[model samples]
Target: MLTIWGRINSHNVKKVVWLGEEMGLAYDRRDVGGPFGMDEAYRTLNPNALIPTIEDDGFVLWESNSILRYLAASHGGEAFYPADAQRRASVERWMDWGFSWADAIRPIFFQLVRTEADKRDAALIERSVARAADLSAILDDVLGRQEWLSGDAFGIGDIPVAAYANTWFQLPVERPSRPNFERWYAALQDRAPFRDVVMIPLS
Candidate 1:
C-alpha cells in the first residue's frame, strides 16, 4: 500500500491525495505536521520535514507537484499526464505557475484562516488580496479561452491551483467577480473525488 505522511488539512498534501483519489489509487495517509507534530523518522524519507512524503512500494518522493506528476505518469497513463512532448510541457507549465500562485496566496490564507482576526496584519492582508485578485484576473483570462488549465481536459496542471482556490473562495475577503475562474471552479466542485478530498474546511 502507498503510505502518505502528512496532515490531511495541508494544502500541499491535498494536491497529492486528491490526485491519488482521482486516479482511484489505493493509499493510506498518516497525520503529521501541524497538530500532529513531525517525527524524527519522517526526516529519513524527506530531509526537509515537509508534510507530504510518499513511500510508494519503496520509492520515496517529496514535493507535492512532483508527486502529482509521478503518480499520473506511472498510473494514469496518457489520460492524466499525457505523452506528447508539447502537451506534457503545457501541463508542466501550468503546474509550475499554479504552485507559484500558491506561494503568492499563502500569506492571504494564513492571515485569514490561520491567524486570529484581531491579531492579523490588516495592511499585509489588504496588499496581498489586491495582488491575488490581479493574479486571478490573469488566470481568468487564460481560462476564458479553454475548458481547463491543463488545456481541453482536466489533468495534473489543475490540481495545485484548485487546492489553493478552496482557500481563496472560502476566505472572508472581498474578491472581484471572476466569471471564467468561477466557471472552471464549479466544474471541479462537481467531481466526486474532488469534493471528497479537496473540499475540506480550511484549517
Candidate 2:
C-alpha cells in the first residue's frame, strides 16, 4: 500500500492526495506536520520535515509536484500524463506555475485561516491580496482561452492549482471577478475527487 504522511488540511498535501484519489489508488494517509508534529520516522522519510512524504512500495518521494509527476507517469499512463513531448510540457507548465501561485496566495490563506481575527495584519493582507489577485489573472486569461490548462482535457496539471484555488474562492476577502476562472473552478467542483478532497473548508 502507498503510505502518505501529512495533515489532510495542507494545500500541498491536498494536491498529492487528491491525485491519488483521481488515479483510483487506495493510500494510507497519516496525520503529520502542523499540530500532529513530525517524528523521527517522518523525518527519515522526508529530511525537509515537510507535511507530505510518500512511501510507495519501497520507493520514497517528497515534494508534491514531483510526486504528482511520478505517480501520473507511472500509473496514469498515456491518458493522464500524455505521450507527446509538447503535450506533456504543457501539463508540466501549469504544475510549475502552481509554485508561484502558492507563494502569492499563501499569505492570504494564512492570515484568513490561521491567524486570529484581531491579530491579523490588515495592511499586509491588503497588499498580499492584491498580489494574489493580479497573479490569478494569468490563470483567468489562459483559462478563458482554453478548456483546461492541460489543453482540451483534464490532466495532472489541473490538480495543484485547483487544490490551491479552493482557498482563493472560499476566502472572505473581496477580489475582482473572473468569469472564465469561476467557470473552470465550478466545473472542477463537479468532479468527485475534487469535491471530496479539494473542496474541504479552509483550515
Candidate 3:
C-alpha cells in the first residue's frame, strides 16, 4: 500500500492523487498541511515541509510532479511516462512549464481570492492576471491542435498542467477567449479521475 501525506486541497497533492486514480492505484492519504498542522514524522519524509510526500513500498519521494512521474513510470510503464527519448522529453517539458507558470500565478491567486478582499494586493492581482493570460494563450495555442498536451493520448504530462488549469479557470477574474483550451478542458472534465481529484471548489 502507498501512503500520501498532504492536504487534499493542495494542487500539487491533488496531482498525485489524480495520477493514482488514472493508474488505478489505491492508496492511503493523510492530511498534513493547510488547516492540518505539520507533524514531525512528515518532516522526516519531506525536509522542506511541503505538502504531498509519498511513502510507497518503503521508498519515500517528494516534489509533487516528480512523484507523479515516479508513479507513472513504476506502475503504468511507457503508457504514461513513455519510453522513447523524444516522446518522454516532450512530456517532461509540460511538467516543467506547469511549475513555472504556477509559481508565477499562484501568489496572485492566493492573494486575490484566497485572502480577504480587504487584504488583497491590487497591483499583484493585476500582474497575476496578466501573467495568467499570457500563460493561457500559450496553452490555448498548443491545445488548439492537439487533444492532449503530450499528444493525442492523455498521460502523465497532462496531470500537473491540468491541475493548474483548474485553478486558472476557477479564479474570480475574466479569462481571455481560449476555445482550444476550453475544448481540452471539457474533455478532461469527463474523466472520472480528474473530476474526483482536481475539480473541487477552490480554497
Candidate 4:
C-alpha cells in the first residue's frame, strides 16, 4: 500500500489525496504537519519538511504536483495524464499556472484562515485578495472557452487548480462573480472524489 505523509487539511496534500481517490487507489495517509508536528524520519523522506511525502512500495516521492502527475500516469492512464505530447504539455501548463496562482493567493488565505483577526496584516490581505482575483479572472477567461483546463476533459490539469479553488471559494472575502469559474466549480461538486476529499472545511 502507498503511505502518504501529510495532514489532510493541507492544500498540497489534498491534491495528492484527491487524485488517489479519483483513481480509486488504496493508500494510507499520516498526519505530520501543523499541530501534528514533523518527525525526524519524515524529514529524511522529504528534506523540505513538507506535509506530503509519499512512499509507494518503497518508491519515495515528494512535491505534491509531481505526485499528482506520477499517480495519474501510472494508474489513471491517458484520461488523467494524457499520453500525447501536446495534450500532456497542456496539462502541465495549467499545473504550473495553479502554482503561480497559489503563491499569489496564499497570503490572503493565511491572513483569513490561519491568522487571528487582531494579528492579521490588513494591507497585505487586501493586496493579496486583489492579486488573487486578478489571477482567477485569467482562469475564468480560459474556462469560458473550455470546460476543463485540460481542454475538453477533466484531467491532471484540473486537480491542482481545483484544489486551490476550494480554498478561494470558501474564504470569507468579497469576490467578484466569475460565472464561468462558478460553472466549472459546480461541475467538480458532482465528482465523488471532489465531494469526499477536496470539499472538507478549511482549517
Residues 1-203 of candidate 1: C-alpha lDDT, one tens digit per residue: 98998998999899999999999899999999898988779888899978798999999999998999999988899989989999999989988888668876889999988898799998988988888898899889989999998999999989998998878898888999999999999999989878988898888
**Residue range 1-203, candidate 3, lDDT tens digits:** 99999899899999999999988898999999888979887887789989899999999999998898899989888789889999999999999899878976798769965899899888888888888888889989999888899897999888888998888888778889999999989999999999989999888
lDDT (0 to 1) per candidate? 0.90, 0.89, 0.89, 0.90
What value of lDDT does candidate 3 attain over all alpha carbons?
Answer: 0.89
Candidate 1 positional error at 11, Å: 0.5
TM-score of each: 0.97, 0.97, 0.97, 0.97
lDDT of 4 by residue, 59-148 (tens): 999998999988988789988988899889989999988998888778888889899989999999889888889988988999999999
Among all windows of 10 consecutive residues in model 4, the one with the lowest summed lDDT is: 100-109
Better of 2 and 4 by lDDT: 4
Candidate 4 stretches with Cα past 4 Å from truth are: none
Q: Which residue pairs overlap in candidate 4's backbone?
A: none
On the 0 to 100 scale, the lDDT of residue 50 in model 1 is 80
Total clashing pairs for each candidate: 0, 0, 0, 0
TM-score, prediction 1: 0.97
Give the TM-score comparing model 3 with the true structure, all chains together. Answer: 0.97
